[model samples]
Target: MAAGSRRVRAARRRQRRLAKGTHDLTEVQWTALLSAWAGCAYCGAEDPSLQRDCVLPISRGGRYTLDNVVPACRSCNASKCNFEVTGWLRRKQLDEQDFLLRYAEIRATLVTDLDDLDDPRN
Candidate 1:
């Protein structure tokens, strides 16, 4: 397809996602999430993006809902697999002290992480 056609198609997808109650993650959002986390939620380092990690996974059976997804670096996502948040967290041997520090730990973290992208920093 033509470049203009692709752009239009992409725009329609964005509009659809917006109407469906989710904001699509651009590469920038993924980058911001990783940078803000400063590496792994499990282990702090530059993490692979092979798979996305969810703050809340779906096989606890969640909606594609905004309150649930997180941009997990690959290994963390793999560690998480398909279990409930706490279950996967435990499997990775993350203690409550550290596990409790994940984005889900504070509702405000969610707001801050996402909102920062659109905010103008001086």
Candidate 2:
């Protein structure tokens, strides 16, 4: 796709996300997420430049929040563009079950950490 086309698509995606009232994924959360994953969430590639990929996709009303986002290498992120996570994983011959399980565990831990940060005692 042309650069202009990509920019336009990204702008539209941002509009859609705003319409859905999706929460922003903060830098702190993103850092923790990347640290937790430590590689491509799909293929386990230890790429230094990981991108934030939406599991459900913005086209499907997916948010940019922690629950919907994960670290993905550029290749996997581009290949899985706008596709459902499990189906894309299946097509790529990756372990869908493992991804789901790990995602759940990581999300839970991150959420708990966030909650603790919100607590006064913390």
On lDDT, the leading prediction is: 2
For every candidate in turn, the CA RMSD to the true structure comes to 8.7, 2.6
After superposition on all CA atoms, how large is the RMSD of candidate 1? 8.7
lDDT of 2 by residue, 1-122 (tens): 69999999999977876687657899999999999999999999999999999998888888889899999999999999889889999998999999999999999999999879879987
Candidate 1 regions exceeding 4 Å error are: 1-23, 48-50, 63-67, 71-73, 104-110, 113-122
**Model 2 per-residue lDDT at 27:** 95
Estimated TM-score for each candidate: 0.54, 0.86
Candidate number achieving the greatest TM-score relative to the actual structure = 2
For each of the candidates, give the backbone clash count: 2, 0
Point out the worst 10-residue segment of candidate 1 by lDDT: 57-66
Task: Give candidate 2's root-mean-square deviation (CA, Å).
Answer: 2.6
Error of 2 at 67 (Å): 0.7
Model 1, TM vs. native: 0.54
